[model samples]
Target: MMAKKYSNKINKIRSFALALIFVGFIIMYAGIFFRGNPIVMLIFIILGMLSLVFSMVVYFWIGLLSTRAVVVNCPNCDKPTKILGRVDMCMHCREPLTLDPELEGKEFDEDYNKKSRQTKQT
Candidate 1:
């Protein structure tokens, strides 16, 4: 069996933002190659700018989520970390942590937080 991997939600979003920034730069750089085609270059530049702007929005969302996330000391690492929902992994140790006692000792499942699941469970 392959070991499953999980990452802290905040960290995941951060990395996604970072990747977007890189993609934006790459798109803009590709535009330079089409310098002879003004229309093509403009399209590339616009697309690049959009990607950058979207990344900023994602970063802002992460900030808001951080405020709502529950902070707790990871039992495995003894380090302060945040959990975004009912089930989230420790930022430092990747230990599966849960805020709900009913979920304790259960396997981590992201679907546990969905509205559909909540309705179905009841």
Candidate 2:
């Protein structure tokens, strides 16, 4: 099987936020073409603004998560990166990393983090 590409959670979310901004702008521009219908244009503009607001919220959330993320140097890439959960990818090299020693040298699996969280609640 081919190797699955994994992304750094923070970087992924940041990309999403960037995409949202572009989408919001596109939506707002679409509103301009609907100038004939004042109500439609108003709705589109409001929706666009809402999208931008949501993006800001997501960005803020990433900031909060960043405060909790663990910073470590990647063994494979020899670069600094942040690990958000028990398992996360290296931001610089996309190398799979784990905070748990037991998981070291094991295949990468996102479910490891989810399982850890579930066990904590039980």
Cα lDDT of model 2 by residue, 1-122, tens digit = 99777899999999999999999999999999999999999999999999999999999999999989999999998999999888999998899999888778888888877966548645
Candidate 2: C-alpha RMSD after superposition: 2.4
Q: Rate the local accuracy (lDDT) of all candidates.
A: 0.91, 0.91
Q: Model 1, poorest ten-residue lDDT window? A: 110-119
* Candidate 2: stretches off by over 4 Å: 1-3, 116-122
lDDT by residue (1-122, candidate 1, tens digit) is 99766788899999999899999999999999999999999999999999999999999999999998999999999999999977888999999899889889888887877889867877
Give candidate 1's whole-model lDDT.
0.91
Task: Tell me, by TM-score, which candidate is best.
Answer: 1
- Local error of candidate 2 at residue 112 (angstroms): 1.0
